[model samples]
Target: MQLMHKGSALVTDQDIGENPSVIEHAKRMGLRLITFGPHCNAQVREMGFHNGNLQIGMGSLRLGISLQSDGHHMALNAQAALAALHALGYAPAQVQASLAHWQPMIGAGQPQLLPSGICLLDHSLSNHLLSMTAAFSQLQSVAPHVSRRLIVLAGIQPGQASIDAAQLALEPLVRDAQARRVLLYGEPLRPLAAALGDLLHVNWYDDLNQLICSLLRTTHKGDTVLLAGRATTNLALAADAIRDSFSGHGGHLIASIQAPCFDPHQKQMNMHS
Candidate 1:
């Protein structure tokens, strides 16, 4: 199954959470620095393309040339991006992670105007899909339709920024998705069940029992659903959900992709190490 989350490049084949070559690729991409919050930590604040913590938290920032985020700390490890920017011979741009604590940065008041290779801004991790939906909407207009969307989460508390981002991202898709195409995330919503009910129509399931019930009611094969974002890996439970309900009706689970970088060949191959 294809991975569906964003910023998979930051995570590596080893799963140790650090990719030595990440920065090298970032540099080749001509990455500068992009700040999200204000000048919080000097080291992190003015760093290069590598980064995160937008939501409490981040899914990372969607730059004018590349990027997309409202957050789930999608790409926090910045060393790779840093190396990349430097290698490109570009003085990384500056990003403002928290403007609420803003100060004179890169010798400029507005980050967008900072002529450095990097740019910074305190993104509103206040909404999940705000970045992704916007990016997807734009991509749909330019690229071929993949019928797949990604969900990237973070290691933050619900109160941090995940809630805001989730509401911003998932709700609209759920509301707009055509019937069987909607794929409710497999992980439990924790204390979020009430919020889940707000989205309209489409089959919504919290677990296998609900998934089967929804299918028994209406669904079909060739239809698509996305299991996006970060959560405790629950493949067994997800398998159970599908297995317990596989027998009912006209539909079949065609794809169960999790998260793949937007352009893995391009994104991952950037590793210089």
Candidate 2:
């Protein structure tokens, strides 16, 4: 693809697999090419969680990238961008400053904090297994001490394969987070209830209203609730209902939804004020 900057144009491969064609084309055009690979010279020195943000130490420059998840690809993308910037004479300090304001797109890696002290991680936009697993691992580290750890999984569609995959992805989070109660909704999640049988409190509901009712009744103060799964109309409705139920309860309700980064949809979480 062509990148235009200051009357100069640069071309690069779309992915690592297309490097051969990109290199050949560059050679034919007498143009210089800069490439990055899986095992590139630039590397991430260390990565950790600090104050709900990801701290990445790269080649003597430390940058804090904000997100609720691990962001496995994001680190690599940053490395490539830094390499390009370095070639263009940008200092490592300048690059670090630019990344200070880098925010994750909504439903991708954005994390929202409700007034009730609940943190919502929205990964509904892209739930690739690896990404989801990374996100949960980060969550496990930053999760605060609370009375109960609750997980709500919405419905998946297109058949049993998707359901099975989601279950496998979530099992580790359930185990690691020590989720005390899990609420499963929709037909696709029926099988999951049996799979997790007797491990913890598993409540299966065919109707969203029933699930919300159970959640409202069972949840107590200082509980951390995580809502994940496919975004459906019913799931949205249920999320709203649960958020409303926490209005005057003086507790947190974390809800994840699918939306673009700039989408302007906001609702009240607490009404006791």
Best by TM-score: 2
After TM-score superposition, what is the CA distance of residue 182 in candidate 2 from its true location, in Å?
0.8
Query: Per-prediction count of colliding residue pairs?
Result: 44, 0
Task: Encode model 1's per-residue lDDT on 182-259: one tens digit a residue.
Answer: 334333333222344443332333444334344323322322222233334332333333333343421344233212
Could you tell me how far off, in angstroms, the CA of residue 33 lies in candidate 2 after the best superposition?
A: 5.6
Model 1's number of clashes is 44
TM-score of each: 0.29, 0.59
lDDT of 2 by residue, 1-273 (tens): 344233332423235424677656555555555443244332433255445465655567676655333355665565556556755767756867566566666555455555555555545443345555655554555465534566676643434465566555555565666666777776666666666665646667665655666666666655656666665534555545445555544233433222221244422111112
Model 2 pairs in collision: none
In order, candidate lDDTs are: 0.31, 0.54
lDDT for residue 236 in candidate 2, whole number 0-100: 53
